[model samples]
Target: MGRQVLTWIGAQAAASGRRYVRLATARDDRPLRAYYERAGYRHVGDPPHAKWPTSLYERAIESG
Candidate 1:
């Protein structure tokens, strides 16, 4: 189900001429972080924010 949702999102983003699919996750969630890493998203950076700690990730959209 997660992969399906990612596929759908990639499709939509590609249709709109986007270059990448970016997301943020809680920095301390190791399991969730691993899941995204296994899904091919690379750890980009953690930008400063006033709210909860976040880790950014991005996956390039494959040209069709």
Candidate 2:
């Protein structure tokens, strides 16, 4: 189901002329991080705000 959602999202982004998809998840959630990584998202970096710790990830949207 996750993969399906990602596929849909990628399609929508491509239709909108976007090149990448970006998301943020809790920094300490190892399992969730691994899941995103397995989905082809690469860890970009953390946001500069100190109020909350989050890990940023980005995946390139392939052109069809």
Candidate 3:
């Protein structure tokens, strides 16, 4: 079941012509953010803010 779901997700991403898919979560969401990095995402930087900071991540897609 997991394999089937992953396969479908890959197909959709490929068909969408997306460059890369990144993962991020709020500071309060440390667990979720950790998951993203573990899934091959890199920490790029933080978002513009005054009171608090926002997390940002990036992943590059294959290019033809």
Q: List the residue pairs that clash in candidate 2.
A: none
Instruction: Report the lDDT tens digits of candidate 2 across residue range 1-64.
Output: 9989988998999999999999899998999999999999999998888478899999999987
Better candidate number, 2 or 3, judged by lDDT: 2
Over 4 Å off, model 1:
none
Give Cα distance to truth, residue 56, candidate 2, Å.
Answer: 0.2
Cα lDDT tens digits for candidate 3, 1-64: 6446534554566679976765445756787677667655688877667256568776565555
The stretch of ten residues in a row with the least summed lDDT in candidate 1 is: 45-54
Model 1's C-alpha root-mean-square deviation from the true structure amounts to 1.0
Assess candidate 2 and give its TM-score to the true structure.
0.91
The most accurate candidate by TM-score is: 1
For candidate 3, the per-residue lDDT at 12 reads 67
Tens-digit lDDT track of model 1 for 1-64 = 9989988999999999999999999998999999999999999988787289999999999997
Q: Identify the candidate with maximal lDDT.
A: 1
